[model samples]
Target chain A: MNLYANDMLGEPIGLLLSLLIGAAFGFWLERAGFGSSRKLTAIFYLRDFAVLKVMFSAMVTAALGLQLLAVTGRIDLAALYVPESIVWPQLVGGLLFGVGFVAGGWCPGTAAVGLASGKLDALVFLIGAGAGSLAFAPLQPRLADFLHAGACSVGSLPGQLGISGPVGALALAAIALAAFVGATAVERIMAKRIAR
Target chain B: MQRPYWNPYVAGIGLGLTLLLSYVVLGTGLGASGGITRIAATAAHAVAPAAIEENAYLGGYFAEGRPLAYYLVTMLAGVLLGGFGSAFAAKRVAIGVERGPSAPASLRLLFALVGGGLAGLGARFALGCTSGQALSGGAMLQTGSFVFTGACFAAAFAFAPLVRKEWR
Candidate 1:
């Protein structure tokens, strides 16, 4: 399951709430300097770390929040759905996706915002995405086996790693925190070099 | 003047809350590209209704009637509108191409097209985009999502220098 209201047929929300949430999502992304291709790509060049910081911070925030809620028994953790494990396809697909992201300067969602915010490049990108999706149909059978390869069970993190949920969550947080700190140090050092 | 952004940490909390709110309200996480897929599938059906019915993947969304009535499509519409609204309030809205200083506008546009094509292609094989898979699924501690995120970052890092001229 997901975090929005839906009818039995499976819609996410009422139209109005959907728009409001989407706008907020877009607004925050822009405020974080995501609307700019340069800013987004800057992380790759080690010129800016906002993308990593924002993403990691968001991940930790949500993960920790969910973990806390699960512990408190406020929210039914089991009811909340997560994506299933599909290893090989995702690993290969992710590599391809990431390379595309650096080249294009925006992911699917951000590109939507980028286009709306008047980035012509983003518009072109979206069009390409459309074509690409359509193009995948013919090659489907060949990639089909790979796509479904490595089918591990769902919520397989702690179970697969042989740890409790809280422990796994904490470990994730610690790792993210370390990365955050390291990123900050690297940013400072890079800025100093640039200044010099 | 445009209002400044909320701090990254603060924004992260806000986004996280939105995500959490989504789970509480709808019992799932946030997603972006699935909406596109639904819409795209619906649109594709327009041209080939019979073929769509035959195709296992695209046919699933269209089995009912119009694919436009679905939630993901609505969410995506909201994503566009929301993004537009945010850009509007920030005065970040402008009509033009974005490119690196060293790159020509047309060249940048071309790269954007190719890059986007690859991403769209990759997202499907992965079963979702960064929104549906990585951000939403990652927080939920989904194995595939993490794997996907890892590959994406790894690939991006590996290819960043190769495509440096496109953005450098």
Candidate 2:
């Protein structure tokens, strides 16, 4: 049985493993230049598509890989945790996150990377996020209903569309490929305009 | 001189693999905001343990023992170490503020604080941030994640023009 499914590993060991995983995650993010707020914020300007390209590619890869493993009986998809689908909260929260992304030039993860790379602004951003989180704790009681709004059965695209998981994965991969092509085209045009 | 970053696609694949490993091994995906939120809880506990224990959000963290004992908190520490290692190897570690030439440093810092606060609140509302919800949930084909992803990019693009000066 897998560690996650059977509780083969204890909490201390599990947390230790997280360090290695988190390290790899951080390394790749830094290698992608996510440590630089300027590079990350460039996506909003349409001058750089690294954010889109990286995120979409990663999503497609993980989606396809997980489905493949599931289909092959190598892993149990059911055992993996999936976040609940709260539509209204997620949608509105996403909008707010996007605005903050453009304004702060960093998200929670990348901000950590940025701070590691000695970015003072990242430090300030972290502080603000901490403070905001503290503020949220108190406000959570009042916003409980709104946060739970649009509660639905945990949903997946494949399950909702009446398609197989592999098919859904393929569809997402196709979309990602098309988006990459389109994003590159837009970046080229934008760069040319700036040059002129 | 500093080294250039890897190709976006290559880095993307690496990130995807890392995420997959997390799922297979831990039954959960990567996260960041959870750790940060815990820090806030930890601080609140120090000030008013009873009050923190009574709160809905912060209370859950305390229920699990120490607020900082969660997996995400340890992972975040690793993120810091790994990020520093990579940046140091590439000679990219330097203390500075990154902003467009047209934007003043003070304005940029102020925006960062406000924007960070908004993002923190948003993450709480959604129960996840970009990494936890958008990336991880999207891979699982979760419908709300897609909605979150679509709404996020749409809103960002819509408001981008107003904040163009800050970045451009």
Candidate 3:
């Protein structure tokens, strides 16, 4: 399959398709109630689990779909762009991003949704985020070495585990199912406590 | 009043399909932070074209031509339009600051700004945010994505209490 790999669609047309893809992304986010800061932050309060549920589901679905396509030879998995797994910076970055998530009530993507939904705070958050990125520019050189620490030789989880892609995807799906059940239980328990 | 939101699982499937479409058509996953960073770089470039272009981090964005011409920026514009359409259809499009009852609007906005800054900085460190790293790369079962996901949630849960008043 040509699969539009390596910019086969070209820049102008590719960008048009990108716009449609982003529209779909934002559409689902809003439908999932991510446009609301309270709804997003509710996970931190143990008041809701939409974030986890939605995220895990989406991840599992894509993983499984990719595996299936690869197995069927419908697409070449190697053609996809997979970011490297660098441990230290990603771990530290995740920690900081998490705090920001609960505090700001949005990530980069959902913040755009929030802003579109007319949340004034989302606008301020975006500006601050932009400034934050710019702030990191000058420091990039100093942190370059530390940021690249623990770069995994094998990038994908399947490769790291020495398992086939389908197996790895299945494992992830199972984990997601278990987490969904646990998330529901937690939400139920939280609801009961609030009721009292 | 706005209608209720879609079920998480259902919406997630929709999102996943969209991601799959992106991968198939573009051979790349979705992203948001890259666009945000590029926009910042472009704005800074206008004021200090030499300085911005010379900076190690921001300079790379200008290497391929105008930074604003990147696909991520166009996708971001699409996100805004799509979000607006969805919210409008659901009657959820209203101008306001979202916050807890006890929190003042200014305080809420302040927190938003600070929190956004932190998230943005963190995204750059991790090389992506929730969309780019946790979701897009995550779907590909990248080890760093899982690490980032675990650490992000753990840190958020640990720190949520400190800002309890913001959302509680």
Q: Using lDDT as the measure, which candidate wins?
A: 3
The Cα RMSD in angstroms, rounded to one decimal, for candidate 2 relative to the true structure is 1.4
**Each candidate: chain B TM-score:** 0.91, 0.95, 0.97
Per-model lDDT: 0.77, 0.88, 0.90
What does the lDDT read for residue A145 in candidate 1? 83
lDDT of 1: 0.77
TM-score of 2: 0.97
Name the docking class for model 1: medium
User: What tens-digit string does per-residue lDDT give for candidate 3 at A34-127?
Assistant: 9999999999889999999999999989988988988998988888876789989999999989998888888999999999999999999999
Q: Name the better of 1 and 2 by lDDT.
A: 2
Question: What are the clashing pairs of model 3?
Answer: none
The 10-residue segment with the lowest total lDDT in model 1 chain B? B70-79
**lDDT tens string, model 2, A18-129?**
8888898899899999999999988888889999999998899999999999999998888987789899989988898888888888999999999999998999888888
C-alpha positional error of residue A45 in candidate 1 after TM-score superposition, expressed in Å: 0.4
- As for lDDT, the candidate ahead, 1 or 3, is 3
Sort order, lDDT high to low: 3, 2, 1
The residue-level lDDT of candidate 3 at B90 comes to: 99
lDDT string for model 3 (B1-168, tens) is 999999999999999989888887788888999989999889888899999989987888888776877788988989999999999999999999999988889889999999999999999989899998999899999999999999999999999999889888
Cα-based lDDT at residue B102, candidate 1: 89
DockQ of 3: 0.80
